[model samples]
Target chain A: AEGEESMAAPADKRPISTIVIIIAMQAEALPLVSKFRLSELPDSVFPKGVPWVRYYGIYKDMNINIIWPGKDTVLGVDSVGTISASLAKGACIGDVFLASDVAFHDRRIPIPVFDLYGVGLRQAFSAPNLSKELNLKVGKLSTGDSLDMCPQDEASLTANDATLKDMEGAAVAYVADLLNVPTIFVKAVTDIVDGEKPTAEEFLQNLAAVTAALDQAVTQVVDFIAGKCLSDL
Target chain B: AEGEESMAAPADKRPISTIVIIIAMQAEALPLVSKFRLSELPDSVFPKGVPWVRYYGIYKDMNINIIWPGKDTVLGVDSVGTISASLAKGACIGDVFLASDVAFHDRRIPIPVFDLYGVGLRQAFSAPNLSKELNLKVGKLSTGDSLDMCPQDEASLTANDATLKDMEGAAVAYVADLLNVPTIFVKAVTDIVDGEKPTAEEFLQNLAAVTAALDQAVTQVVDFIAGKCLSDL
Candidate 1:
């Protein structure tokens, strides 16, 4: 199983000294950025034309990296996966990843997913006790090709017992699979897919309302990162 | 009545040419910040010892300012209001404000509110046709002093036909009331208070999932601002 792969990291490898927070957009990174007062890494530091950009800082004496892939899961498998795999190739056993994003499934319901469900990679690696310790509601998450909050799409996903739907988490997991690292998700419910027909332009309308809550969740995730990975720092 | 106040300003007044995006934390401002690539306003710009801080920039040729009052509506009436009213005293007739935040109302149901509900400000100003054009579900928003997502609290709110609950929107309205400025809420549901004894730590557990949606909603808000206020720009 993928969980065991992380546990069995060879003694000769680096002992996983970093914690990465990957998000789809800058907003998701703000709370952490401000909370840690993170400084933006200069463009000159990265090789030109890289598909992703990151902010680096120290929090609680731990090295924390926050990355935003240029876009969402639309590029997760192809671009994000490749980049993540390369960065994680030499990552140690305790290296942690907390992938965050917005999702839809139930009607006007906000559900937190701690466990990931995908087509393959049943051997997916998850954080040792992040969900259990947080006492959050864990459920199966199905990643789709596009935003799936419409009534018709909701009905289809619900029929299969998939309570959560997203665009990029699975792809991120694919990258984790390639690197044999442990990852967990910290998602917030933005809207319930009732019969309302939402256009791409209207997608983020409710974001302001839910941001206060997202700030709190990200804070918890940071707390968890400090607890589990501070030893490496 | 309030709508008339903002709509009937004298031609010589400041003319309300600015659009302010008010929120509690940096996360809520993420989508808008990145979409506009807003720059932080230095503390020296505002009169010294202000209770809140703001970021300002130009989006689509309109003067856009995003403010975070250090916290939520908990300070809206007292601190946020005094500061906002002072700023709006010279604001123009057509200026717009898009109030954003996470809210909880019914038990386990996240509902969006397009209409502002309070003791009196019934004819309050609204974005010309933004909500109707978008076909969003509009309803009454009841603001309280604390987080109202608790089980017993939710039952009481539903009994009053309150579709949404927030800590800051109504309070922001109080500030708008003082300055006679038009404001609308673009809120998203973050949690359903259905018997889920959510402690302070657990309030934002599901935020990551919903942030993407919130991001989309905020983007739309920015677009609306561009369309409605660009003439002023």
Candidate 2:
């Protein structure tokens, strides 16, 4: 209930009609594309030669678009949006977690007032009822572009009290916030950042199973979101 | 006339009313802030703890907002936006240049189709008349976070045919594109990327004079942009 006040419906109270799912990997996007029966739009939908891919379809009353921002790993968030989902580190494999908040671990602006800006913290949209109904783990998510954790990043992560770590979540949150759109993060854990096993090996090994779990959890989230305004979540 | 087709006014044809100038350094922002006779708002305009600074005032009919995005080197682009100006490498000191196009030199997605996405290329809003009127140099801009260029970055910049190098222009262009806002870039050269002197020395030596030159050029740009729609630029 800490963030419940901020969850009050906006003045417009428009019903959610369009849903965009931003996926970072082809492997993750493939399952959702098939499950949602999304048709791939032509490459021409984007400017010439950009590798971004868009898949769209109507699921019930919701218009759904799944975007894959190619292999370069930057997310282009152009959705009338909500829900930035991705695979996270620092949790058990296949555990589904909902972000309570998001911040950056790699960006450090050490100036007195600017230190806060360096972290770029943002709250995830509150969804208490839905979170309780699904029994999802809820905690802070930290992001950086690097897969390997440096000591400074570790310090930043500790400072942020981050329970989930990913390369893309905060970037998506920043964009979503800029658009005045509320966002909830649904992340599936694929590898433990501090575990003895190699990150790439564990990640690749668990990616498939985690992707399936994530897909199921997200589908339920979408179902819960249907026929509701943002505050309803 | 090459990019003229994309310059047609939108159906709504709303007259431009708000102008946001995103400056990375406080030194760069000070002169413009003084010239525009802007007042700094309380830090509370942004979320608590973020160090981003905003100075605003009416310049003629335009509501001008100049933002300094803290010391962390990350740009939080929250504006009903336009011009993204910054300092550049690869041109003579105090030379003001206008970006014809922008791209990232560091993001390389090597997959066959994804390679194009790796470049993240975008056109600067067409402004031939303004460029001609100001006698500004017009060329491609390549961006990356690092000031020190690697061999791969060099190759990419060459491939991009970059005439200027900076840390933030392409990113601003990317965000502006997502918002369907056209962006034109005006850059002042401080250090040559491949020049003989150490970059830091050259940059420090030239920054004050260059900032002055940049401030003048941008003031003229803002003046030219007044009383016009985006297409008019």
Candidate 3:
């Protein structure tokens, strides 16, 4: 096994050099920034016309940047290209992506997975192989903006056939794919979208707690990436 | 900080001996069981009248058990006491609890936290202190059994004033609190539950994916406990 390990080809070898974490919330980004000791880059540092806030710093010798897509995927598309081009700067070295966001699930459980599609693109990108390493569940994630538009009824879910549904996962996945960033999506569940209750109230009441959980999930991914990169070295 | 670290009382320190994870789905359970290499205990090994199947094994030298509480809080009440007592058998040693399930939020983003109230318990329980270490959000959790019975309009959210809502979190918390066990409730958002789509159809479609996310969150908790315990050693 040691001989086989050493015999592996270098061309087939991809050591993670930089990891770009694209997330949706400032809350989610704050904890990771602090945990990994990330510092916000100057606004002028970002590419011109970039619509979202971008933060950059290093964690354990790996370059890490967190991008906030502000609220939903529609907001993300405006800056996806800018985000992609910026990441392309590190293309000379292998770069991987870990996109984090929230989703609405009908079940009273949160399933984390790489989303499968965005609006225009079919067969969107995902890192299923990596999901296992991170102990995450991989499934088809549906992306849209409004919960009212999201399938809240069993009939809707059956019609959609998407196991995972979110407002932004697919858009991030789609944009990352176009940029050729090997991306893995990390999402934590916050609410059960089964039309049984009013969302505004639930969200307002549980926002702090759910955001906290999302923060934790993001931290785990960051740590996993750090550990994975170090071992690859 | 060095002096503070040194002054930390070793006598008051208790290493985690067992970790109990209560969840609602088989999809969530399968992943954790496999990742941690947990094995099922014989049905007969469980205390008589146990309503749910329990898996017990070791993950990083910690006795980790995964309990399936079926779909909602109503189902959980059946086995919560039994599960609590089982863990109490190892009560002389310190034990920690990680409760994983799904929730509802109004906004698209998923917030992670423990909800506060539910169907039966007038007062609910949650572990907010553990939220930071676990990277989870702590807040009021609302638990109930029927999705239809849940509030489904903006009026409801305004009326409830809760940020997080769920079907089972409070029940589990109430039971854990009653058992006098120190527990941390970890939940991911699944749906907005704010009257978008009818839930029956939606739940059937997205059940698998939501549960998987819950499973991943649970896995993180287990790993956290293991790492925390190992560092203590």
Candidate 4:
């Protein structure tokens, strides 16, 4: 609650004791970042002064900021700490949205792809008292800057039992878990991941579906969050 | 080093020491339990039949058995700590390999192409003492798995800045960084991250070059190990 004390009297331009850490694997990635900030939502989350409105457009009601660690988990972890610490963002409210391909699409790596999202989900869902199934299976949305050819990765996914493979997804999960956030992974299948023609065309074909999936998943969590928030109210 | 205490002990099938917490990412991956056997390294480093191996594959040393956390830094951290703390493995030597995607390729996620291997290298290399030009990149090495497009990954390696990406590479690096082990990510890029064909095809094309690069990189470190081993003798 002291977090509120410091933010309530903010001298400069910062939020009121609440901040969210949205980790983008690659900072230049616009597509992935746009998903979290659903434009059609009640109010646009896009900041007014930011010039990259077209590029950065924000997600609604989410106090999120982005950082690109360029694909290093250790550094990514450090970056998470640094970014939040720099913004003086509190660990109490720093939620992360991971951006990467392997995270949302299953079977990108040779090892059991199942464990890829499993670890993240397990860590996120296993946090204290939380519903394991319904909240996780449907509400947790996976985000990725790109997609994969599912058919190609499915075999590996089957082999490894992975649901998604986004570059930044796990890193975000790992960090958020460490910081203790009700981390939600909004994963959308961008590619078949079968290793066939995993191209922009493939991504475009799946974009809207994945985006819709992310949108629905985020909203689904509203039920759970509302319940939790109601307790506070 | 407490490792020296168990160094002379004979390998036994019986369990000894205490506390065995296996942080297996894949429940189905339980087969790894039977497949791996500790004590390939040295007795002092590990206890009885903990049945483990580093990262992947089997142990040739028979001195210690370690089930290396395959990928994902959190699990890697969890497993290493579990093993290190457990009486079974004891606090001996922590051998971990941060293996990730060696092949750099873009997966078509719903909206764009996400590069799977971009963050591993960055995570692995973005620390204090690791260097690619000097081939002295970060901490230790334990069992190795390279990206099939290993050669391509090496070719595409961009260290102009700090951290880069690889699949399992940095996961291991994180553990090593924590445990203070000199790590080597012997990754062979099976394919380039930006490729458009079967990773196998790219693997075929780049394997030779990748192997050479890996061999050279590994040899430099391996030679260092050999030199240390020889000096001790």
Candidate 5:
């Protein structure tokens, strides 16, 4: 379904010209795309053998990673270790985390999210880019941990004016943001953060198309990024 | 050279016991036997891999696991993920990393490590004989995050004391310990925490005997645990 939507996008409407490397994992990928109401993405979007894959077509152009560091520190850092190696070998880095997922053990831990983005941006800027300096942005991203999106509390949402939610985007943003990279988390409110009635499947169907559209827009921006000259990049 | 040190062991030291299982990866296997320090152990105990080696030797009596996690997280967990899946299967969890390998940038953060012995002890008391509980000790562990150790830096050492000066122990302990299992760490300390002038290769040679002895001791302990029962005859 998402594939059809993306395919139908007019060249002007298609944001392929600026495709940012959407490095995402697990739950983060699902909510982002599901909110766009994108039913499915191109098969080419994901390589075979990913750790988690609950969502569809929105990740079509992003480099979706499967490792989640938050729950399993070792695997999480293992992903980072590989990234570090990539950095050593001269990998270009993004400028922000654009994190949207935030859940605490208590779900009440003060959100140092802004601080997390601040640090990530600092480190990402140093990523092996042709240009030593890149403009970075950190924005509020909405996300939940599970595909069902049934656990989010409404009071939390009402407190923070977030637009969408997923599990993985926040971690992605946290890591990248600390690297001092610019990040923008385009979010969609698929489910009430806290609600008496939560329907994950229904929420997914409701927001899928909008997410695909957002992904399309984000991809164009990233494409613009990839085409920039390193010195002036 | 380390293997050769086993030569000095009394001829009878080599166990008549052996057990082997097919594995898909080497990292998981390395944890069971290779993890010990030779200096602390006696002779004859060792992990034997196959192709040309004697298989049905005295080790037929050995309760060994030639394990393979079977192709990277094929089941709910990758060997590199963390303790969750290992815990779920109720398998012998080895190498629950205390410190992470510098494969990613997120490796630098300090985290708490809880020992399993305490919990193991609790298990033993509850299941008395079915499975004994082990202690869970929480302490700091460190790996060679740097090329050399700063032994002179009292503060750092104090801060990271229980920290495994090497990497693999804590991971093993983390997983095993969490489930109230007894675990041992035999690290080949190529780099001391102290600022040493010794080259890495040179240091390993000096500690070769120690490593060998430690390795031997650990093997015996493993045998003891596996054969906790009295002689049948």
Candidate 6:
């Protein structure tokens, strides 16, 4: 929170009314759904044939909505039209990281102005008090569709000064920023990007345990956020 | 239009009331802004410090909004939270192409099920009558941030069976598909991805001419779409 002053403020700083948790993988979603005792709507709120699932319940005076994009679909930009975290760099598995900012590491638009644009660097809504209370690691999160990083991706990651990498964080940040919604990312590391094990193998081996940790951390974060205004956080 | 039967129907087939044209570059946007006689908004509709520009007007009973992301920003997923054309394969300069489908040429999520999601293959809304009336070529459009293609990108593009390459088309198509907004892409070729000339040089050389062609084609398409239902297209 050293540079909290530079972080963009939410368009609206009113007291928290709703908290939406967006999960791409079903494994990461189910545990939280059960913990919150959310009800799966009998009918999908999405367009017909899209496999996205929604679960909602009231938690501590806030309407909590959890969305799972299902197995077949990746998180599309539109999911935000309706509606992060758990990965890191140089971190041990199960270590929780909160996004101070987010960006894209895979895109490389080399044109003069576009090179900056292609990186899609965005600031996550500041949550300094919550970070201090939870003792969280706060740093930049980089996103791309790919699971493993290549040399070019590595260069971009370094350029982005990324502390965590994931598939969906920046996208969520982008939309949240656009809508002026205050956003915070709580991520539990499952596998280190530059670690010894192959990403896929290590991810599968650690996913369940890490997801539980993420669920716990997110619940704590939510509990702290329930009635407080974003500015207070 | 050969495989039109498989195209997904719009969630709503009502008459078009508003048309949104999202242009990433100012050069590509200005002509259409003039053609439509759109007035630039005096106040920023977006969050402060973001350079996104908006122009609006009414043409032939349809409300038209043109958005330019400005020079410094790439089209973020959020831009769609607010809204295709002109690059092709085997296409001569100034040749207009309509997107039959769109996909990403750069993302490589290697995991099962996720890989399919990574490719993000999405079909553009079918426009058989519009294509027939305009005499425009229709083919799969591929999007990536890079101005130039690498070997891996080429492989992905081939896997996508892409006939056009662009920076922003697939993102736009993805959002439109998710919203069931009935999207169609009309592009004028500035440079061919596989051509002998270096992409940057060719793109810079041809941009003005191609954009003018794009403006004319888009004007005609708008005229054709004015006061018509999505189903009519």
Give the best candidate by TM-score.
6
Q: Which candidate wins on DockQ? A: 6
Question: In order, how many clashes per candidate?
Answer: 30, 0, 62, 115, 125, 5
Model 6, residue A145: distance off in Å is 2.1
* Predicted structure 3: lDDT: 0.45
Alpha-carbon runs more than 4 Å astray in model 5? A1-218, A221-233, B1-63, B66-141, B150-157, B172-182, B188-192, B199-202, B229-233
Q: By descending TM-score, how would the candidates be arranged?
A: 6, 2, 3, 1, 5, 4
| B1-233 per-residue lDDT for model 5 (tens digits) | 01122545442344423333222223323444344211112222332211111112223255354433322211222222111111111112132211221111112222122111111111111212222222222223432212222332223334333333432233344444333333333222322333234433333343434334333433544554453422210
Worst 10 residues of 6 chain B by lDDT: B77-86
**Candidate 6: deviation at residue B190, Å?**
2.6
Model 4 Cα shift for residue B160 (angstroms):
13
Model 4: per-residue Cα lDDT over B59-137, one tens digit each:
2322222344434444442222111100011111112222222222232223211332233232332322224334332
- Using lDDT as the measure, the top candidate is 6
Better model by TM-score: candidate 3 vs candidate 6: 6
Worst 10 residues of 3 chain B by lDDT: B81-90
Which model, 3 or 4, shows the larger TM-score?
3
lDDT of 6 at A69: 74
Provide the lDDT at A149 for model 6.
74
Instruction: Tell me what fraction of the real C-alpha contacts between chains A and B each candidate also makes.
Output: 0.00, 0.03, 0.06, 0.18, 0.00, 0.32
- RMSD (Cα, Å) for all candidates, in order, is 20.3, 8.7, 24.0, 16.9, 17.3, 6.5
Candidate 4 docking band: incorrect
Summing lDDT over every window of 10 consecutive residues in candidate 5 chain B, give the lowest-scoring window.
B114-123
My TM-score estimates for the predictions, one after another, are 0.36, 0.58, 0.37, 0.33, 0.34, 0.77
